[model samples]
Target: MAGLKIFGSDPENQPKPRQRFADDVVGRFRAGHTIDDRPASLDEWRITTGDPDVAARVYELFGGEEPQEGAAKGEDNIEVFTAADSVAIIIESAKSLRQRMVLWGRSGKPIYVSDGEFILDENGHPTEERDPDADLTFQERKEKKDIGAVPDIDLFFRLADDPDLGIFLFKTGSWGLAYELARDDVQGALEQAEGPVKAVLALEPVSFKAKSGPRKGQTVSYTKSSLTLKGAA
Candidate 1:
């Protein structure tokens, strides 16, 4: 008898861009096309497709001379926003007190979280579901029968320089430090800020195991040491 099998049990296979390109090249080769005399290498192809820096790095790895400083704005040139940079702190909601720190790039688009599994819509914009408790006031939540002790506030931060680097969550101790640094401003914003606020964030890199989610045992880094409020919107 044929072995039993579960349909769709295996994860969906998605090919990377390079893999697809390689496959295309193989197909051409099988069709009696010669690639040995091609002018462009795989790295050159990558450079033409918006990854010149990666190509440069690969060249250097193969004993090529290092490119001059500031010659290219690849991975090395990404600027990590420090406490010196003013960040736009958008209070996304009053009920959830959902806060987001935004940094605008020179290109006029928000730079953050280019990779990682964030809930996004078909148009490639971040999307969040409407919270069921969004309509409830804080006091109402405190009085609800099913509600337990308020869940610990979890804050996630994305690096401004490289969006594809993924996001980091604040540690519990770091959360305490941030509270101490901007307690009044945070409380005030939650209570009365009408829109986005401004703040200067002081962050220290930290690594810890995730407390929840499928990634519980995995280590993750976060910038969550402290924050200072600049002003309200």
Candidate 2:
């Protein structure tokens, strides 16, 4: 008797592995790839995912656009800022807590910064002494009032014309003693504002020891600071 031949046993008939939409996009982003000197676009995204429909959908989801040919790169296209330079930003939206507010900065970039913590040391200096490794719960932190708290500010910024390249974290004391003083001044201006405001932020690159997570011992650059408010919205 002839050996039985199995139907649908051919390797060529096997279905190809399904591609993930998010993973393809995220991988490119992590590799620091760009389209037209900005973040990658749908066309470029398609090269990796090989799914035109999904790539288009992802592009639309991010509100990204293809860079025009020969289009001049605007000053606002910058990814980095210096202390001497000021960024005029609009506050599109904000989520505020006692100590911090995650803001949608100019161009929709997310800005994570402290309002100023409530906890202070014996010398009356704000400190984050709580060990993240410690087996402490949120309720315990609340009970101890160890929750990070910062001063309230009324300041906001005008929306940027373009989308943000990425997120930024502006710590109160990330720059230095002088930058901290400037940040305080900006906070004071916000406290006095009666309505939505536009502010020019003075940013500087600073490095500090990581206080939490696996990166605890590593040093990283701090890229945000509040310089001054330009005007009201």
Candidate 3:
């Protein structure tokens, strides 16, 4: 498989939050093996599946404390992520692509997103359906909330601890499962594992510069580097 060039704003202009996330993602992409970013055509097919609800699964698998303020009283808190540690991911898509798949009616193409085991309603009632894109009523958001959607520090370690779904970078193209990079090695403090497992990632689109002035097209690509697994720290 060939690699795709990742384009982004100037590093200097990127906020700390974005830069930190991007560096972490790029570092993982470069870990354990020499990887290259080559130019290729954009993949028409794509899949995304990291729901906030499933965030708790990460904390449960790893070790971390949840936020104190929002957590229900007397409930044991799990450490995951906080407003102080939130990260953002930005992906590139042509208007055509976005409209065709992500938007409604244009083609009604299916977009893959996360669907956890449960859902919540106002007053903390459990619900049967888990609709990722269902419009949330004001009451639903005000009272009904999913504890699992929130992130915690524990999620990092869980990825490292769990064998089934460890820290990884998963990419899919037209057919399916294009590439997956799971980092099991923790190198000193730079990549230390605080718990039994750890996983973090930043995902985005690959970008490139056009060669010619007019009408010349650019390309995107995806490639698998190497997979490494070090023991718990």
* lDDT agreement with native, every candidate: 0.35, 0.36, 0.28
Model 2, 14: alpha-carbon shift in Å? 32
Candidate 2: 10-residue stretch with minimal lDDT: 23-32
lDDT of each residue in 57-89, candidate 1, tens digit only: 333322333423322244333111112212223
- The best candidate in terms of lDDT: 2
User: What lDDT tens digits, residue by residue, belong to model 3 across residues 98-138?
Assistant: 10011123364323222223344443344775545346442
TM values, all candidates: 0.25, 0.28, 0.19
User: Which regions of candidate 1 are displaced past 4 Å?
Assistant: 1-152, 156-171, 175-185, 204-224
lDDT of 1 at 147: 34
Q: Which model is ahead, 2 or 3, in terms of lDDT?
A: 2
Per-candidate RMSD vs. true structure? 22.1, 18.0, 22.0
Ranking by lDDT: 2, 1, 3
True lDDT of residue 23, candidate 3:
17
